[model samples]
Target: MTTHLSVRAPDRDVLSDPGYQAYLVLRVVFSVAPVVFGLDKFTGLLADWPSYLAPWINDLVPGTAQQAMYAVGVVEIVAGIVVAVAPRFGGLLVAAWLAGIIVNLLTIPDFYDVALRDAGLLAGAVALSRLAVRYRSVQRERGSVA
Candidate 1:
């Protein structure tokens, strides 16, 4: 009797295949989520995180909570654009920004859920970065780095 064994290889061939789709999905999701939330920061269409923390933000940030909100909006919007247009650096930037948010959330007890979500999003961004790095490396080896 002959038995056939199939091995899922992480070699260049497998990495070159549709496996990179995972990266694209993560990239798009991370990119879009920031854009959406960032827009809400400006438009107040979504739940206003600031209002919830208004009582404390003034005491914490020294009369700069509103400015901080706007700044966050700008950062998130820019990060979103970067992630959507420039995949290479965007993933890393988004991951870093999300890490900052996670830190801030850790300091706030009421916004734990938002912080957790941010963490999950940050993980996705990291996954995208890893995938992007792997794909780029594979492409460079093949002289087709995109």
Candidate 2:
């Protein structure tokens, strides 16, 4: 009597996978963009950051519009760092931040265009979060995650 043994093929490299490649691109972009924008809030090279704040939001906060923007800059910087370290949660954080920005923009006159743009960004953040979930699962199976 002869016995045959079956051998399983090794899994494909995740780096070569297209979905993983997309996730990497999104991860890098999401991680860097917010940090850059957040820093710019202090420099004002991009735009007048204070001008973007809605009057209602400014009133609700305990400071002037510019002061509020300073706080916003801090939050954005932290969010960006979080994305670099843990994208699964960072993406949701960015999405929530964008949602707040959208609502604020909608309340301001002549800022509807900005609100629409933020909505698109919000969608991208959500996508990143979903992709991170899949990536985390793969990492867990590989014993790379604790």
Candidate 3:
């Protein structure tokens, strides 16, 4: 005779809502990505990012494109930190940053795909903002229920 038993608990699916999972994943991604890319701007360990800057934006900045990228790096780092602490507002900041990136990529020749990708990322950040609000409300309700 053999005994059959369930090793997995059915109650463990508490956080299994796909939308909630996606929102959580986006939170982590948006949190870490900007920080990593921003830090890379200073190190150039990834690439000399200034080379990707549009000539038009370069013209507007007083110093070198590298200097402007350094400034961008600082903003990106702050955005990541803000997202980590408060995604509701930070998501909009990231969306704005992505919009700026999209515009910049548009100015460069032969980078339409990258611009398109940034646009998608911008949309995701916006979605993340909405999702964060909803998730917080649900969490509050759950807390009250408990």
The lDDT-based order of candidates, best leading, equals 2, 3, 1
Per residue, candidate 2 scores C-alpha lDDT tens digits across 122-142 of 998889999999988886676
Q: Which of the numbered candidates is closest to the native, going by highest lDDT?
A: 2
Q: Which candidate wins on TM-score? A: 2
Residue 6 shift from truth in candidate 2, angstroms: 29
- Weakest ten-residue segment in model 1 by summed lDDT: 5-14
How close to the true structure is residue 108 of candidate 2, measured as C-alpha lDDT? 95
Q: For residues 69-115, write the lDDT of model 1, one tens digit per residue.
A: 77678888899899877677899899999888777777776778988
Candidate 3 residue lDDT tens string, 85-113: 88889999999999999989998999899
**TM-score, per-candidate, Cα-based:** 0.72, 0.87, 0.86
Model 1 ranges off by over 4 Å: 1-18, 52-64, 138-146
The TM-score-based order of candidates, best leading, equals 2, 3, 1
Worst 10 residues of 2 by lDDT: 4-13
